[model samples]
Target: IDRLAPSVVTAALDAAGQGTAETRYLVAGAGTMASLAVRTLVERGVAPERIMLTNRTYQRAAEFVATFGVGAVRWESLDVELQAADVLISCTGATGVVFDRDRIARATQDGRPLTLVDLALPRDIAADVTSLPNATLIDMQVLAERAADSEVVSDVAAVRAIVDGEVGTFLAAKSASRVTPTVVALRGMAVEIVQSETERLEARLGDLSDVQRAEIRRALRRVSDKLLHQPTVRVQQLVDGPAGLTYADALADLFALDPSAVDRVSAVGEGATND
Candidate 1:
């Protein structure tokens, strides 16, 4: 979106018969695209002080004043700013047309030329602005028509495939992380149970050798692991599906797993990262 702004500005200015001359600019947004537009203008030798930023929220516009070294306008003062500006680059992403013919006519009543660049989907500038002698409107349709015959240099499909793969990997890893604590807690429970049972068995069979005791403990652990294997794997798979964390919650509830145990596991992981 940022990269597209320079082309939009260049084409709009050319259509208005206005070249890249020293002129006042009113950027009708403080969003990412607006910030990029301001940066692009500054890079093209337009003084930062020549640009002004405005948004629906006055505070948002004010926040960027220091960063961009540009003046900020209150939302209510948009009309006042529009009148003073020679070029208006509007990308507010608002629902309705921000400036209609009447507003533009009033702003240009003094015979000042105003070039309006509407880069929004539901265009910020009204189509009727073209009717005014002093006002020029350049919208998305104009840009699209200009680029209709342009050549494609990048492999769009390959880029989309890479994006899709990265998004999928991110989501799967996020799902796995949510269920990891429960899995760890379940295994910890199994270990405790196996150890307790093994100790009881050893005490009852005092005649057994150390080798026999160790074998009994190993056998108990194997039995516990086998009993747990399916549910642990299934819970993880279910979380990645539509069920999400519902299955993880169910597993914890059914086993009456201690919530603190999960918290402890998470805390230990955080401590390890800090180390």
Candidate 2:
């Protein structure tokens, strides 16, 4: 409710006139809802000194001023506050009209617009206030309509779209990353084959010197590296594109990659992540 309520207030401000630097915000209640509304105003760059709080009791207004660092108004000075305020939000639980027609009309006499946000349950601002010129009233009905049609829903939809896009991007990245484990497994298989072949040659050549063994190992390693390089590079680039999964399958098949090795690598990675 806190997240959503402010957008309605801002929508009221947008539908009405955007205030000038001289605009004063008058909140006529000191309730929780009123606090949320004031917080919204402050977050939107409304200076604390430019905001005035009024209630039936002066202490309530004073408490709000102390806590929020805004100005305070007496109950009797509501009309003067109304006249000074460019934006008026009513959260008072008054059954009758708080800012009646006559006072509103008189307050807006200087041709300045007043944005009235009525967030009361029993309806603080009169329904007839809309008929008055230069008085833009955003009551429960308007706020409901705004919640349904404009700002709030639009913003949510926009954010949801961005989230969906990011999810798709993440899936693509995850798919591209799958090929890396396959590449590592293929390299491991090559090392096992090279070691087995070296062992066989050493047994056959029985009396070979350490230097001859090292030379043979170096030549075989170079051949294996050169043979794997092109395939690994091509697969990495293609893995970022549409047919990445198919390429991974093909690589596994072509290299006769051991599925157990990839699973072991994945298990190790999962263990590391858990730790």
Candidate 3:
């Protein structure tokens, strides 16, 4: 979901010929949505030096510049950046308009074409910004209308299908993570049992060779894998079903496994895999 929205924004920018050298892009937020927009712009061959970022929090704006900066200007001076920018993608979560008629007028006075994208729910750019000469405001509602008009019926359906598939994939991944702790706990129990039995057998058999120890380990591993195979597959299948998390929780509780452990394991796995 995070990745998809930015690609959409990039496609829009590419369609508008904003991915070129002559365009100067300014993004006014440091949040996830804004970050994604910035990332998209940078990825689609927009020169970093031609970009400027301004956030309410100076530190956040600086951090954004540091991470995605490349050639981006970390504007401690917001007004200066706004005045100089040719294209502005405003995704700020402000309650009121961040850029008004005066700002729009000033930006347009520079004689550069300005494309303002107000992606916020309660639009960050004032309605009057569009009235200014050379300033074109493209808000979310307008973008939606444009999309509906321009998109082919089949392409729209394809996008919807992609979104649905992504939603399902995310839910399945979450559900699979939910049951992973229980599986781990079960495997731990099996290993403990094996170790205890091995210790008991060691006393009876007296000193066993390294080869015997290796064979025992292999046998235990095979047994554990065989024991877990069916339940593991079942859990994976359940991930695609409704109430999968609930079923996973029930299974965990029934097995006396800790529910929080599932989240911990999932977090660790996600971190490890960079997902």
Candidate 4:
């Protein structure tokens, strides 16, 4: 929050026509958020000499002077410092309002433009301060209300789209995995049939040479592979749809495959995954 919230202050300053290099910042706290706001101001081109730091405890304000190279004002001098400031960013952990409307009106009686930012919970600046002339207030509630209309919403929509696409891809891959055991069992049955036929042919045709027997075995295996290729590919493609598991069951029934064979293949696949 220390990093993100300060950007709102910069936006408010810009909207108020408080040029970074010339604007005077009166930061009314010595906490982490306040220190970061100072750093933000300097990084955006505000002169360190023009920024002032103050806290309820005077020593707390003095401690940060070496780090930020800005003037330190005691708590008693806050109003005096406020009159000279172009922007006031108050984020003190105060129990109540630090600057009421009347006080702000007095500070801006000269009619100079002032931007007040209240980042505290109970609010360091009163809500009615906006009624004062030549003063604009941006608080937490204002930031929240404007957020949905900001450019950040478009970025958020883009991120959500990417996440949705990834989830769909993962689900499709998981669905494809469910029919793997069936495919493996069918392929195993084809291999056993090819081996048995090749052995039977060799025994019946004893006069045939080794080269002729090898050629016959290769041709039979190629025919089996070509016939099985389209069905296996189609089954895998359909498994990502609504009736995925039903297609696997239909394949098993049509082939008259033994249940034990598919179960054995499934067990082996599971063991490999665990390993």
Candidate 5:
């Protein structure tokens, strides 16, 4: 992401009708994209003082300066920084408009053309600013479409594929774990019935010897175990495959299992994996 910012600045400069050597950059956020944009500019040989970095809070801008050497970080006099900039990238997460029409109008009044890129979701820069005489506005949608049309840059596509694969595996494991509680609950129910039936038989046949009662109880347990063996093993096997989650969900619904118990089991599994 940092590697693309210099080329973006170059394009933004050309669109604003500004010369390369004379350009001054203003970064209007301290987030990932904003920091990457600053790093990109500096790596391309722009002087630190020539880059103006600002955040919503002064401390965040200061934190950037501490981490990435010194730069023109400002929390106040935003208009002055905007006025001097040939290109500005706004990547703040603010919900409402940061740069409205009137602010852009006042900043660009000095006859210098300005290029503004809005990287926020709801947009930090207003769309109406495009109507201003020599000003240019670039939003996230334009940049994304342009990026999609371009060829893969330096094995980035391969890296993205790897990340996607890792995410899929993680999701599969999480889905498989959902059946754990249901399996445990089913076995517990089986054991409870076995104990209850054993007691009833002992009470009805009161004169039976202890050894015969013990053997009969063992036989009952074996029967229950045999009945469950195939299903439990099959469920485990099915849970590892792509269709695993569906089978797990079906098992829970068919058994009338407690949703809260399933969720608690899943949460515990997630926390253990996280650790």
Candidate 6:
């Protein structure tokens, strides 16, 4: 999704030509999504110094500049950036409109055409923003619809297939992940039993040969793997099917496992890997 968004942003810039070194851009958010958008613009040939970032939180603006190696200002200082910017991309997750008609009109009164791209879910740019002279507002839904219409029929079909395949893969991976903790716990129990029995036998026999102990350990591990094999495969198959989520929930419930524990594990794993 991150990759796709940047590609889309790049294409938009190519079409709009508003992020060149000569053209200034303002990104009005320092969140992860906004950072990505800004990063994309910079990577696509917009000079870092030419781009200005503004976030509601001063610290967030600072953090964004530090993280993405860009120039940023607090929202309170937006007017300075607004006067010079040719393009504005707003990805702030604000509940209400961040830019109203009056604010946009004020920016345009300075004599520069303003293009605003609002990527917020509830919309950061008010509906009246576009009504202002020299102001053009583009939203995600509009861009998505445009992309959808412009997409080739075959390409659209291919994308749908890819989405379905990816959805299936994610579900299967999730389902497999769901059972992992239970499997680990069960294996831990088995290993404990084996160790206890080995200790008892060693005590009774005075001392068992090292080779015999090693063989017993390997055998116990093999037995555990064999016991777990079918269920693991079945669980993965269930995850690939239509009832995958339901089956995963049932399995987790049946094993008395915490679903949130699985989610936490997945989140940790994702954090560990850069992707």
lDDT winner: 4
Q: How many pairs of residues collide in each model?
A: 0, 0, 1, 0, 0, 0
lDDT of 4 by residue, 1-275 (tens): 33355555555455445465777889999887787778877877778899899999989999878887888999998889999998898988776788999999989999998898876655789999888879999876676556655554453345346546866786887798788889989998999999999999999988898899989899989988998899999999999889999999999998988889999988998898899
Who is ahead in TM-score, 1 or 4? 1
Per-residue lDDT for 1-275 in model 6, tens only?
Answer: 44355545654554455444577888888776687777787667677777778888888888867776778787788977787889888878775788888888888996778888876655788887767779877765555556744453344345446656866776567666655554454445556777887677767877678998788778877876787677656766776567765765676666566556666665766676556
Give lDDT tens digits, candidate 5, residues 123-227.
799999999996888875455455543542332444345546866787776765766766776777789889999999999989999899999899999999999
- State how far residue 222 of model 1 sits from its true place (Å): 1.1
Per-candidate TM-scores read: 0.54, 0.50, 0.50, 0.51, 0.49, 0.51
What tens digits encode model 3's per-residue C-alpha lDDT throughout 101-167? 8978876797777888876545688887767779887765555556644543344345557656866
| Cα RMSD, each candidate | 8.2, 16.5, 9.7, 16.5, 8.5, 8.6
Predicted candidate 2 versus true structure: per-residue lDDT over 120-146, tens digit per residue: 665688888889889988876675566
Candidate 1 lDDT at 92 equals: 91
**Superior candidate under TM-score, 3 versus 6:** 6
The 0-to-1 C-alpha lDDT of every candidate, in the order given, reads: 0.80, 0.80, 0.71, 0.82, 0.74, 0.70
lDDT, ranked from best to worst: 4, 2, 1, 5, 3, 6
User: Against the true structure, whose TM-score is highest?
Assistant: 1
Candidate 3: clashing pairs of residues: 48-71
| lDDT value for model 5 | 0.74
Ordered from best to worst TM-score, the candidate numbers read 1, 4, 6, 2, 3, 5
Q: Higher TM-score: candidate 4 or 5?
A: 4
Task: Please give the distance, in angstroms, between residue 57's alpha carbon in candidate 3 and its true position after superposition.
Answer: 0.6
In model 4, residue pairs whose N, Cα or C atoms come closer than 3 Å (at least 3 residues apart or on different chains), thus clashing, are none
| Deviation (Å) of 259 in candidate 5 | 37
* 176: Cα error in model 6, Å: 37
> Of models 3 and 6, which has the larger lDDT?
3
